[model samples]
Target chain A: MARQLYELCGTDPARVFSPFCWRSRFALAHKGLDFESIPWRFTETERLAFAKHDKVPVLVDGARVVPDSFAIARYLDEAYPERPSLMHGRAHAYRFIQSWTGTVFHAALIRLIVSDVPPLLDEKARSYFIESRQQRFGMKLAEVTRDREARLPEFRAMLSPLRDAVLAQPFLGGDAPDYADHVVMGAFMWARGTSPLRLLAEDDPVWSWRERLLDAYGGIARATPRAEA
Target chain B: MARQLYELCGTDPARVFSPFCWRSRFALAHKGLDFESIPWRFTETERLAFAKHDKVPVLVDGARVVPDSFAIARYLDEAYPERPSLMHGRAHAYRFIQSWTGTVFHAALIRLIVSDVPPLLDEKARSYFIESRQQRFGMKLAEVTRDREARLPEFRAMLSPLRDAVLAQPFLGGDAPDYADHVVMGAFMWARGTSPLRLLAEDDPVWSWRERLLDAYGGIARATPRAEA
Candidate 1:
């Protein structure tokens, strides 16, 4: 069986946008592996039951079923040892970077781009996304990102560690993109797919670094459709 | 020639207190290397003219002299490849973690503990410390830290990345503490050495992780004399 990766998408299946799914997408591309994108929508637990996971980023590798972005990254490195390594056999070395990107960076980003997400979902997925997100945020979807532009400064400030690292070297992985870069770039891809907000200044080193990653791996991430800015 | 590390000290030469110095100290211990600590005062840049650098963590290892903490870490791994690896030969993997520690974690810590530092110094060093720090802060040293207790919540929130990582794993480097662990632990050592401020809550996972690191490498970090809490 051909490899398949179930990704979270919206009204347009080509607009796959879950940050976790993007992590796996970049990981696969980085490993020089090919997989078909199986468009999974919001609240699609039944579709992912085969993997015993409710998440969209379920990977069907031949007969093997793998779920979760970090797990998939680990699996790809182990299964294709011949490919370029992601965590380089020291998986723990990348865990803090993953945690920081997920907990801190994404938390700040959602407030800036989340309000734009519902419009891209189908009617059924839109309801699910809005209710679930609003409940988590304890506010209306629109209210959460009403003044997003005003909050951009604080959000950009949170990118200092990333900014400093890229300014010192080419990528977080030093000279090239690695699993650490994939994890963070995944978050940027999320904002790119849904919101048109200017997250980083054009002059910012982070913006330049993102541009470099976008062009990495035969332009895998760069090919993704971006929302109008 | 004996390996000697020039470390910042207050009145008591035994109190090696600079956080950057602690990084090298722990890195050397992790590599099973021994070095004599040469006590350095705040205004003693003249004493380090031979190293061509005005830094507290000047490491004179036999004939090779290393001047920065990050450089010392790389040198230890390169110079002693037979020893336990620090970067595991992927030095870039650790850069973001180090950048986060140096830029975010240390910035928050100084505002909380900068005032406590000067009193630990003798008269000559005390005057220099206060003047330099005040000039940088653009205010009196005491004012920089005044009402710091009220900002404890913000400081702890800044540690979300560290808190999240240690909670999920034993150390940032996974099962065993690595150079990533050493970098952040260096920041904690700074607070412990110069201030009585309770930086970490009793129940924080970071606090427990710090306990583990404090006892690491034959308690080299834990044995350092800390300010009374």
Candidate 2:
């Protein structure tokens, strides 16, 4: 899936950066695979724009449209099996990370939604953010608005398990980055890159992993088109 | 994991049957596998009970404990790869089903929580239901009264995509039942067996699937023992 998507639209005819596209692009680069990231954007009125889901992180591989970061990450593991495995040997741990990345990161990402500066966060950003949040948290955003202030402590505490793991090993899987590391890092990167979530990494070893990973991907990354629905 | 949990429990002990356990038990039968159901009364004091998550349909396979209908069903698929693949050939469809079972059913399950028998209602159950709503809507139980009235329409709409697929095949996958069917049916069975949800099944093919599956599981269907955390 990753290979197919990469084969199609992952490359840029002219290279500029798209951070959302950087998730897969980084994964590919992490595996040292050759691929291109064709950055795509949208204006509210553009019918054929890549942001059909109104999200930046869609991957179009050949004819296949892969949406959602979890799906793209899984595609990377399956398509590039011979390259370093994201899962490595710990299947249960891998599944745990996958579940966490898909669900739990919403809190971190929400901080990004309120931010300004990203060119993508234009006039439609507020409406688009609400729509995406609705699709994700349901039409009721308040349902998800757990007191971020109160919950931050507990949420911050939860990362200790991962921090302990990363501190023990160079990567989440030990010695090398695995699926757990990449997926978690991809989420952490996005959250940190675009939102107040960057504060999460302050004075933490997890931040080191993030910095090294982004650096390995050649610093700032580009966006890829959201896969066609 | 299913076999492992079954073996660990000895399957000889418990005798209470709730709608949730039946889903997992029924799936085993549909696949022609043998197992035991130890009935559990979901209560706050029972740390091992589905009450922990304010949900039923928890399955125990050997020493390993699997929570969430989707996780348990998928674990079963992984543990027993033979028989038939529960997820059809389309990966996205299987994922779509899994996601619905996880997310949409979560909303639907909230309705059943409020509608169950009075004797079965416990502190944990009440807290989870009310708190989830409060957290989501900032409203109290007085605001969103019954489960059926509040969430059934949304539940039915969500199931529409799978309606035809379920009818064309004896199970969600094909002529044979698979993990997808079990996960979905298990969740539905919980509702059908317990609350007012049984009446709502008449209009949908999913209801028929539930009936057919429960009938197949027959005598072997018993309550799973309350788990200890």
Candidate 3:
């Protein structure tokens, strides 16, 4: 399918961001599409800027307000078919990887994140969830993170199948990075960069795969600054 | 975009059975496409009948295998363009609802199913997980279900926004069932049918939405049955 052309839009650089936002950025980078990342703050006043959900990762490309990671990925794929394809020709493999990474892998990863690391969050989200944490779990941020710490052995065990799958492939699919790689690259990047555990891309093939992907994307050094507010 | 024909070749009913599968079924129904639902038992020996992933929701029409819910949805959207559109002119709204129902809503609901309700599982899945449940969660089926029972307050709270959204629209996308509606209907049906939360329909508009879609699909009773194993 030929991709349609749409101007890329996103949050500005000066604002604090979330992993979901980062995923969209990485996808744009992967496709080599230059978009304007308009900075957005998650506050009551920001409703007019975004939508009712009060979330980042809301892509405003012209008249399009593409929300959610998968949709953003789809929009990119359809909008930029001239670029590298995130979806391989084998529809089943591409979709399987997309769903696994986006849905199953993401679920486990997010649970670990919110439960395990609050301090790592930027001031905005951390400050927002502080009271809710104590009220709901009867614990402070440290307690929650520590409790998550205890589950590492179990978490690592869970991630093994994923590790094996990616290790077997050169770039999340067979030879090139597809949408699954992008979905995972964003989350895995956060987990590897921000969290205490950082279980991914450490040894042998998994580590090497991550390194190659990073290398292919200009090694993260050339990232465009978030669009100015 | 027209939905290209794909084959779902298999013979094991329970192996690939899930809410997502039901969603795909309804999509086929919506398109009024004459297709076969091939069930397959995922025993080690029979796994090779399919490709490597050995997963259900494999959409095979002719030589193509479309896996994962999003890809399948997109494929359907493309192949069956003349059919009622999955998204209205509001691409953002369509994308948001699709992701919300398929990813976020599906995540929370599936966790409860895997962690809480094992006995209610079909015989195959139950036997597969019985021995490992203790090592994973320090509890068996009954205890897990009890834990889920305690979380009702949290579930209801988490679902408030979604519930309100559905109540706002006659359908999730407004006035008619779209791809997102099918995505959510599958999950809600599984949860409501199998849990104490079966009364979701009385309180929420989603239940009625599901029934209307099913009614549109010839009320499920007259739907074709899978061939003999």
lDDT of each: 0.91, 0.49, 0.54
Q: List model 1 lDDT by residue over B39-119, tens digit each.
A: 999888999999999987999988999999999999999999999988889887788988898889999999999999888
**TM-scores across all candidates?**
0.98, 0.45, 0.46
TM-score of 1: 0.98
Question: How does residue B199 of candidate 3 score in lDDT?
Answer: 30
Better of 2 and 3 by lDDT: 3
iRMSD in angstroms, per model: 1.0, 12.7, 12.4
Model 1 interface CAPRI class: high
**DockQ ranking from best candidate downward:** 1, 3, 2
DockQ of 1: 0.84
lDDT (Cα, tens digit) per residue for candidate 3, span A75-166: 77788789876552222223333443554555556555554444434566556556665676676656555656567566555455445555
Tell me the docking grade of candidate 2: incorrect
- What tens digits encode model 2's per-residue C-alpha lDDT throughout B1-229? 4452221111222423343454456556655666554433434335455325544455666676776554555666677778554432222223434444555564556554443433234555445545666677566544444545656676565555456455545665455455556556656544433344433458687677766665544634323333221
lDDT of 1 by residue, A41-137 (tens): 9887998888888987999999999999989999999999999998899887888998899789999999999999999999999999999999999
Deviation of model 1 at B144, angstroms:
2.2
Give the higher-DockQ candidate: 1 or 2.
1
Model 2 chain B lowest lDDT segment of ten: B4-13
**Number of colliding residue pairs in each model:** 0, 28, 30
Which clashing pairs does model 1 show? none
Native contacts, share recovered per candidate = 0.82, 0.00, 0.00
